[model samples]
Target: MSRFSLVRSAPAPTPAALAAPPPVAPPAARVESKPKSPARDAGLDLRLRLHAKLIEELDLAKLDKLDEAELRRQVLGQVTEFARIERMALNARELEALGASIYDEMVGLGPIEPLLKDDSINDILINGPYQVYIERRGELELTPIRFRDNDHLLRIVNRIVAAVGRRIDESQPMVDARLPDGSRVNAAIPPVAIDGCSVSIRKFSKKPLTLEKLVEFGAMTQSMSDFLYGAVRSRVSTVISGGTGSGKTTLLNALSSAISEGERLITIEDAAELQLQQPHVVRMETRPPNIEGKGEIRQRELVKNALRMRPDRVILGEVRSEEAFDMLQAMNTGHEGSMATIHSNNPREAISRLEQMVAMGGLNIGADAVRHQIAAAVGLVVQVMRLSDGKRKVTHVTEITGMEGQVVQMQDIFVFNRTHTGPDGEVFGEFRATGLRPRCLDEMIRRGIPYDTANFDPSKVLG
Candidate 1:
């Protein structure tokens, strides 16, 4: 090896060897710490421990067999004894509230019962056991309420489905049913729900809102309500279209009240919720399949059967499936004054949905044929929308004239023009006339319904 090789072969002087180790410093002081844990509440613990003791002391199985009155008495007795023994630190008012909450959990929805009893809650949306939201006065608010665990939430969902005599599990994980108070419930669980159970409840008031009441509530103008009153009385085939929860069914119910009480009326719904007050009305609800997957009745079947019942007016709670074709056919074939709701953002989409639904009904026809049928059968399209401010307004009230070329022509007689949103997130707009006269005024005159041409003029916009 060369001297250069010897020089290279020498162990390279290491930086750590050449440089003295940094002077050792004193160790930093150790700070004592504890494992992080969630905050604890004495009230929650007292109630929970009391509930646990009551479960053991009382026979829940026998309690289930007892009637509501006896059950309440037994539960109250158990709570009274448990409170006396535990000597709970809570005051009397707090103790009573705890007892009531326990009772609600036993006989009603547990954490959700309070929300259900809330009159101002329009909707309850549960993402899981921990995330509960409510739609109150048209705005969403996250609530601190939660289920004890995922299993607790699942149990409540199962209970709700069981009460309605429907079943949802891994095999069939979705269900739509109505509560005893007529609130619509939709639920889904895993594997359909990856996280946990999800539920949406759309609440209905016990006393339905009327057209005049809706006007008073700022949902629509008096002039618009007047036009709708005239339209319904004149036997017009109307379709209310909008996004989900946009007040479609509410509008449908209000319009049905305008139908002459003398006419024999029939209503078909997946769930019987139309609270029409007509004396001669017959209500029909569809049924799901049995456990054996038989004995199912669809809305299309009901629509076809309703025609044979010789009804003067047929109201469909909604036309969602192939039933749209039958509903349209009914509208044309002497079923005047018929009404149904469709999901669409605007009037034109409503027309297109009708055609699509016709195709869905196994009609072997061209698009033009379906469009033509929609043009003839459907007369007025009232578009309702839930605005950004949580207020529902009549966004568009359009009239469908005959087809211009291949497309069905629509004229917007009234429209809510939203030009801007306010700084506070409120929608700023006004209902304006589209400067087009409605053709239905001629029908009003022919039918002799109470209406004025001045009310249906082109220039009368309402805010």
Candidate 2:
């Protein structure tokens, strides 16, 4: 018999009980009744019990060998049997929901599984066991879902990292992991995260966003898109700069579609979130140290190793450290179409950040030489930003026109001019091209990559 027992239906009424008369009420008196305490959710408690029973009955050792379909079938069957044995009153819909919840807790990430399955949610932020928040349509809203406690929340985190052959605990209080569908996961616990275990999941779109889709979404104008397509096709090395949640990676992915299929591509990242559609591509991810605090592999090492892989282009997911020096070397060498993303406010700040990163490499090069290297290596700086209204736009399309002494000369080709905010809290901006034509237009024309000089006309509002 199972250890758990449920309240069974009352025994059929006996004949004597049916014959007995109703009891008389006592005389009226001012007897006070205490206020009832708040009741807990009975459904959550039921699901938790069912989850525990399911885990106890299943042969977990052979779970890995079973296909998802078969495992799901077995889980549903077992759940139905368990409910029937316990005499729990559950309808078809309720039974199915119970089965799904049990399955999620058994093989998925527990309480957050439903949130992860919701395509509408862009981000899942867990503040603690009691608080969960999701980002939808660019605004954050709290969800009713929660863990049982801190231990429950930590178990979910452990499951996530373990799937990717990683671990998280007090010794290594933070970790970066990815879901099966390529969503990025970052977790911190205990001493590192003061309140409780916190997890941030950045969900990627099921369908990869292309340049055309971005245009339709008003992320950029048709003219801006055309210019970027031409720039990428002409093998102009570019850098995408943006703040957090600013669609930098999305823009980078869209622009990468412009790359020729014939060229081999190599991508390096901290968590391997890029979804390149090219057949000839190699992806690399950085590794954190093991329990012994050894065997840590950083992005810089991967950047150096990618050089020997014979790539037509090297794509860094994001340059945050000394890898900027090696990335510059790749772009300055034969890898002309290489691209990467950076965290910055604007084009000017992006260049300055790159300079600082190169210096972080502990190289003997002077500041002037570093500026020249940046100017020669990066041809275009695509600045993206998330507006107050939660919409993302390409704020600047800047071209590095080489160096004049210590300064790297850059000119704005396309700019987003924010005029006003709408009554609905929407940001109203027009994407316009400056009157001065970009110097890269000549390079694009030389490469026969289909030029459109009209895109640079000052009178034109591109988007």
Winning model by lDDT: 2
- How do all models score by TM-score? 0.85, 0.91
Task: Score residue 248 of candidate 1 by CA lDDT.
Answer: 92
TM-score of 2: 0.91
- The whole-model lDDT of each prediction reads 0.80, 0.86
TM-score of 1: 0.85
Alpha-carbon deviation at 400 in model 2, angstroms: 0.3
Model 1 global lDDT (CA atoms, 0 to 1): 0.80
Cα-based lDDT at residue 456, candidate 1: 48
User: What is the per-residue lDDT of model 1 for residues 1-463, given as tens digits with 9 covering 90 to 100?
Assistant: 1122111233333334323332435533433441122244444444555555455455555665778766665666556555655554667676667887777776688789889888999999998677789999988999978765566788888888788778888878888878888788999988898667899999888878899989998888888898898889999999999999999999988988889989999999887778786899998988888778888899999999999999998899998889998898899999888999999999999898888888897878899888888999989999999988898999888999989889999999888888899889988787777767889878887887765556445565674
Q: Write the per-residue lDDT of candidate 2 for residues 224-302, one digit (tens) a residue.
A: 9999999998999999999999999899889988998999999999998898878899999999999999999999999
- The whole-model C-alpha lDDT of candidate 2 against the native structure comes to 0.86
Counted clashes in each candidate structure = 0, 0
Best by TM-score: 2
